[model samples]
Target: MEGLLTAETLYLALGMLACGAVAGVLAGLLGVGGGIVIVPVLYTTLGFLNIDPDIQMHIAVGTSLATIIPTSISSSRAHHKRGAVDFSLIKIWAISIVIGAIIGIAVAGQVKSPTLTAVFAVIALIVALNMLTNPNGKAIWQSLPDKLVAQPIAAAVGGFSVLMGIGGGTLSVPILTLFNFPIHRAVGTAALFGLLISLPGTIGFIYNGWGHPSLPAASLGYVNLIGLALISPVTMLFAPLGAKIAHSISKKALRIAFGIFLLLTSIRMFSGKLF
Candidate 1:
């Protein structure tokens, strides 16, 4: 315990707190709950700490999902209070999402770091394109699929979200809005999906990663307790603020901003892997 109190660790803790704050705001604002921000940051942080490259991306992704749990809950509640969340949709999609999340964990555990990186880059690019094309919240499609059709899509969202270390918002919001759901409502509903995806995903990663080598101190499998402790509270504190702002903003402006964010993030992640 004493050894963990070093200045370097303290700086890392501060960095985690900063990341958490940003993630919380993004969770509330974009229904993404910071997993998008958390994964790459954790990957870099772990590398700086000299954790092995072989498992660093896995640890980063697992830890990001762990952090998303509380962030998503807080953001969802804020959105729910605004009457923006669709609980009925959540009920319909929950089971399928959980199943997908479990499948994602299995796949992630078997894959290599570069493979995971490439997957993230591709997903991010696709999502960015989707957002870029629909900045006004216009429905590209007439309606969302019925429950039967939606189940598989929901599962895919869950699986992909788990694999990418994101809340399902990056995919879910775009899909929902393309089906004519209001952007704010889609964002709100996506927050719930994030929770559903992260909880099971985090548990699966922890179990799968148990006894693995090169994990940082205080890590439970790939989930780092120190990171969670430092990040969760800060995220909870700021999420509501983001929700308030999201509600007040113009949808067109917000959509454009979020699209640009996704584009930049995708490019950064892709560059890291490619270059």
Candidate 2:
């Protein structure tokens, strides 16, 4: 407990709590899996703490995954209560996601941090642009061959989720909506998909970072156990509050705001300075 009281520790904890609150609200409202919010925040915070620049992205992704475990559960449950989840889709996508996550983590371990951050930045920019352009969350494709279509998309989602430390909701919701699924249902189902992606993604980071001496104290491989523990519960507690707000907001307004926020966050991350 005394260790948790230093100025640095107190600031980190408070900062994490604030990030968790914003992330929880966003997760509930946007079905975004909160990684967009969490990743940049963690990265910036770690940067401030003078962690190795080379490992910044790894820490960002790992810490985000840890936070998502609880955030996803809370947001998913809220959406579930509103009858939003498409369990059938989850069943179809789960296996491929697990496989992809394993591969993604392995790949992440071998890659340089600059490359990882660059790739994540590109993806985040694309997602943000897509959201801005498609506020209605409409589908581009009405239908497709189930096995062929579902498998590839699921794999892609898993791979990206692990690489970017996102919950897959950013990609998943758009794809599902493009397939003509209603926005609410797509959001709901995407939330569940996040669980599948995060579980294996987190494990992959753990395995990938195993025995790395530079890893901070209280870390499990790439995963920051302390950061996760500090953020998860508060995120869970505030998620339902976000859901209630989401229900009241206009979809277009929400999409625009979130899109802008993502763009700003991406830019900040690319700048490589802690704010």
Candidate 3:
């Protein structure tokens, strides 16, 4: 325990600060929980601490979701003020998404780090391709599918996002746009989805990882307290700024820039699968 405390050095603190800053902006601007950024950073940080490779991805994913809780709140509120959030959709998708999240936790516990990383890479690639395309262009459909069909998709988004250590915005935003939602509205609604995906995700991870022998100091299951404390505050501070940028900026530029970032991130995630 003493050595674990000693390992919480300046390097970890600085790394988390920088990670948080970028992640915060991405959260608000991209309507994501910023897990694409958080997962990798936390993974690397834990590696530097000599954490068990078997559990590193689990901790990173859990911590990333934990941090997303507040960031989604901040980002969603900002979008709501702009009339971009759809409360009806929120009500419709809430239950199924939460159920999916719980199932995701169960699945994650059975997988190793490589499998989780692979899933993240593949999904990130898909999202990057969607973003690079004309995200706000003509839609395939006139409106969302009926609730019976849509609920299952919502469940999948929640579960898949848990595997990727995300807030579900990366998946939800694209899905919403496919159903003819405006870009801003999709982004806003996805911000709420982040909350739904993350709250249960964090709890499930903690519960699943309880009494794990490999966790770091100040860990609650797979969630790292120090990392959460260091990251969430800055993300909250910047999420509103990101939301402001999202509303004010040109959609095209946002799409292209975010697309490129995800493309690179996906590639990197793919390359890091062995670790």
Candidate 4:
């Protein structure tokens, strides 16, 4: 085991620490689980370790979902403390989101890396478009839709979030704002949904990838414990700082900036250069 810590590995570990720091701030500031950043980094990390190409995306997604647990907890707690959370919406959306996440986990296990990569790219494209086209966040309706419509929407958010290894904020925050909810409240509630999605996503990925031979060291199934250990605490520490930033400034600029990032990410994914 001592032999495992090569110079390259040490450099990778430092990169993950930086990734976690950035992810934590994003999680709190944007209500995302930082899975967007974490997934790609973990994917690259696992590939760098010479894990099988076939399963690398799965492991990345699973590990990213695992990391989201702490990120969501820290971000959500910060939001809750600030009275930004709306439990009523959380209560309404919870079950559907869990169901979608379960289905996503099952499907992820059955698919190959290319498919998963495409899913991420497509989802990222959609999110990027949303952010770019509607950064100002105009409401589509004066109020949220009733349960029948709302549940399906929530399910989509959860399912896509799991597929992309993202927290619900990537989808949920925009949807909430479109339904006329305040952005801060939308971000807070999305943080809770991140928890809902990650809990099931982590377990399902673990079960799905259990005993896979190509997984890296310290892996519990596809969730790499090393990555988790290295990333989670750092994210927790910085998430509150993001929350503080979110409360202090308008997100329109950040929204546009992130949209550009997502756009580049989507284009990169679609170009097949990374895969």
Candidate 5:
């Protein structure tokens, strides 16, 4: 254990813990899965650690999902206690997300790091813009056609989850809200969707990276076990605190801050590879 605490390892651990704490709080408060906060941090920190650039995105996404598993569970439970979760919706979407995650993970493994980075950057930009334009539950409960609308959304959530290393909350919450669901209910359901996304996403990363010699130490495919182990507990512990904070702040302010964070991270990611 002491040996594991190299200067680089310790730095990464501290970073992970801090990130987890922040993410956990936000997850609890905003009903987002916290992956948006986790992925860029992981990518940047892992790059700084001198891990191979070729697999950096894979590692970042996989590890992010790994952390999400526990974090989502804790977050969902908290929301469930408050009667926010919609069980029926979750049951409808889980199957599609699971299948989509499997396929997405497989595709992600075959893609190059540069491509993945670019993709992530674009996604970050889109999220930032969306947050800036619409920052609340105003779009919730808008009413859409029944099963026809849900299937594609569920599949898309799964694909994006694997690609972005998120629990689908970023997409799920907004969509659910658009369909006229309450903001709290949408958030809670998104948390449940995260479970479906992470399980298959984690497995896919492991399976895709199996027997790949270039993988870093303590890696199961693109997923970094060391990073996940160090960060998850911290994230789980602090998520409720974030939720409390969320309740205290205006949704618009929170969304704006989160948007700026994503934009800056996305720019940094783009610049890192370019320079």
Candidate 6:
């Protein structure tokens, strides 16, 4: 480990720290897995290190999902303390979500890195647009489907979120709110879903990426322990603070700011492949 600390490694470490910090805040603030922030940044960082192109995005996705495990637990506990979590919803959706996540992991392993990047970009753009136009959940469909209808949607949410290395809140929150679930409860429940998604997702990535060649140092399959080492603690530290702030502040401005950020991030993801 000591011998690996060249200038490049130092720079990467610093970058990971920043990514972890940002992800923590977002996880708390948005009840997300922070994969939306971490994936693109990791892609950039690994690109700089000139790692194997074939595995770079896989590493990013795996690491992001792995970090989400602890981050989601922390954020979910905070929200649960405040009575924001709806355990019934979690109970209702749990099995389906897990099954969908397994399917997503299987599919991700078969897809190319560029295809994954494109999928992330598309999803990010949709999320940004939703946040920008419906910051308060007032713009689009305002009701959730019946359980018979919801089961399939829930599965899709889990599958897509796992594929994108996210916590599922990006899709879950909106779906819940449309069904008239309170926003806070939706956010908290989504945090739990992040845990569900990340655990199986991370395991799947590790299994899928096992024995892949030229993985970066400290990688366990596609999951980079070094990245988790740099990121997890910081993210856990900051998540409660973000949750506290979310409760106290007006989120409209924050939503707008985050929307712009997501837009730019999406553009970067899309353009990276092009150039």
* lDDT (Cα atoms) of all candidates against the true structure: 0.87, 0.81, 0.88, 0.88, 0.78, 0.84
Candidate 1 wrong stretches, greater than 4 Å:
1-5, 273-275
Runs with alpha carbons beyond 4 Å of true place in candidate 2: 1-5
lDDT assessment of candidate 5: 0.78
- Model 3: per-residue lDDT, tens digit, 1-275? 87776666766788898899899899988888888899988987787779999989999999999999999999999999999999999988989999998889899989998788889889989988988886454578989988899889999999999998899988888788778888888888889999999998999889878999998999999999999999999999999898999988877777787788888888888777422
Over 41-155, each residue of candidate 5 has an lDDT whose tens digit, in order, gives 8887777777888888888888889888998999888878778788888777878888888778878978987777787788777777777777764664457547766787789
lDDT string, candidate 4, 211-257, tens digits? 98787889999899989999999999999998898888886876786
TM-score of each candidate structure, all chains considered together: 0.95, 0.93, 0.94, 0.95, 0.90, 0.93
Worst 10 residues of 2 by lDDT: 136-145
Tens digits of per-residue lDDT for model 1 on 1-275?
A: 67766877788888999999988999999998788888888877877878988888888888889888998999999999999999899999999999999999999989977787778878888888877787788887898889999999999999999998888999898888889888999999999899999998899889878998777889999888888899889988999988999999999988887888878777888777421
Which 10-residue window in model 6 sums to the lowest lDDT? 137-146
Runs of candidate 6 with Cα error greater than 4 angstroms are: 1-5, 139-143, 273-275
Cα lDDT tens digits for candidate 2, 1-275: 67655877888889998988888887787777788788888887877778888888898898888788778898899989988888877888889987887788888989977877887788878878987899876668876338666898888888888899988888787677678777667777777777888888888888888898888888998899878887788878887887777767776776677678777777876887635
Pairs with backbone N, CA or C atoms under 3 Å apart (clashes), candidate 4: none
Give residue 129's lDDT in candidate 3 (0 to 100): 92
Ranking by TM-score: 4, 1, 3, 2, 6, 5
Better model by TM-score: candidate 1 vs candidate 6: 1
RMSD of each: 2.3, 2.3, 2.6, 1.9, 2.8, 2.5
With candidate 2 superimposed using the best TM-score fit, by how many Å does residue 177's alpha carbon deviate from the native? 1.6
Point out where model 5 deviates above 4 Å. Answer: 1-5, 273-275
